[model samples]
Target: METPPKTDIAAALNRVLLTRKERLRSKNHWAGLAKIPTTTVLDAFKGSNSTIDTLTKLAEGAGMTLAELLAHGDPDWEVQVKIRNTFRSWTIEDVDGLIRLLERRSGPRDSDAS
Candidate 1:
């Protein structure tokens, strides 16, 4: 399939931010969270030929990984990207802990723990 237009990508990002439900509503707010300048975010959204680095920062500000943001309209792709990014950042200890937690949850429930 052909890649969607930049406008569509921008709209998707706005939609993601809107889903935040009153936490963020402005470019400046997102920029502050992403540690990037407001103009950079605005330019990227406006399709002004921003660098990947700029776009990555914008995505981070919106509580998404770069891959998730780039996945745009594809919900499945976005979810997969989020999962991949999460695993990418996991340390061995974290993975081991998660495995233990999952195993315990799947095992017989402890009345006191519940």
Candidate 2:
């Protein structure tokens, strides 16, 4: 299957901020959290194999919560389609709600914690 649209997937994963630079507010925020030089973070929105920790810091520095970071957006990635012989169910709607609910439940991350 074709990969989802880059924007769609990126937004869903909360990495859109890195690409758009909206997730970062100031140089000092990253400096205080990540040991990496401020320039490095700026250069690498595309951090290879980087974990959520880095993403969290980026979001925090930008004053956004992790859940805010990971939101798949209003279109909703969980809004998928399933077909059966004769019965039809709105699984996508339910799934989308669940994902959004989960996102809301996840609070912000600590800047100091390891």
Winning model by lDDT: 1
- Candidates' lDDT values, in order? 0.72, 0.49
**Model 2, C-alpha of 109: deviation from truth (Å):** 40
- After superposition, the stretches of candidate 2 with alpha carbons farther than 4 Å from their true spots are 1-36, 39-44, 72-114
**What would the TM-score be for candidate 1 when compared with the true structure?**
0.53
Give me the candidate number with maximum TM-score. Answer: 1
Please list all clashing residue pairs in model 1, or write none if there are none: none
Worst 10 residues of 1 by lDDT: 4-13
Give the least accurate 10-residue stretch of model 2, judged by summed lDDT: 78-87
TM-score, each model?
A: 0.53, 0.33
Task: For residue 34, give model 1's deviation from the true position in Å.
Answer: 1.0
Q: Which stretches of candidate 1 lie over 4 Å from their true place?
A: 1-7, 73-114
What residue pairs clash in candidate 2, if any at all? Answer: none
